[model samples]
Target: MTKFLLRWIASAASIYITAALFENVYITGFDAAMLAAVILGIANMIVKPIIVLFTLPINIVTLGLFTLVINGFVLKITAGLVSGFMINGLFTAILASVVLSIVHVVLSGILGVKKD
Candidate 1:
């Protein structure tokens, strides 16, 4: 549970940084970013698994490139569900995914994945 929260915070930071670097993605404020992070966590928990299962063949075919799409979709969903957070377009979402992927990789390596 603690690890999950930490990862969500890291994800929120990554999203905030990515949006700062890119024009199309934006969160209204620091509190908005916090809200967006929790929304993103919830969306990922609910939607990501279904997407992965549905896209398993594509994931296999692309050798996991489709995971990026999944990440972007989750980000987009968070933006749509959260009023103060917005992702302007798919391209911005993809760029954000790139940012998030880097953050996720680094954090996962340092903190490790949850086995259970």
Candidate 2:
């Protein structure tokens, strides 16, 4: 439970940081950012794997780069689901996804949260 909460907070912080870095990615407030993080985590867990599995051939053809697109798609979905979270374009979403991924990784490492 503690680990889950820690991860949630990490995701929130990642979203906050990513929004701060990108002009096209807009997070209304800290609370909205937190909600967006939670929604993104859920979307990643539930929808991402399915999308990846279906897009496996494309992913392989792209030498795994298409996985980034999948991540962006999920991030866009998250933005749509969260009222205050707005992503301006597909390109921006992809860029924001990359930033979020880096922030999440760095935060997890700094927080001593082991990857599953």
In terms of TM-score, the best-performing candidate is 2
The Cα error of candidate 1 at residue 9, in Å, is 3.7
* Collision pairs in model 2: none
lDDT of 1 by residue, 16-53 (tens): 77678788888877677778888887887889999999
lDDT of 2 by residue, 37-95 (tens): 88887998999999999999999999999988999999999999999999999989998
On a 0 to 100 scale, what is the lDDT of residue 4 in model 1? 74
What is the TM-score of candidate 2? 0.94
True-vs-predicted CA distance for residue 50, candidate 1, Å: 0.4
Q: Rate the local accuracy (lDDT) of all candidates.
A: 0.80, 0.92
lDDT, residue 93, candidate 1: 93
Instruction: Supply candidate 1's per-residue lDDT for 106.
Output: 74
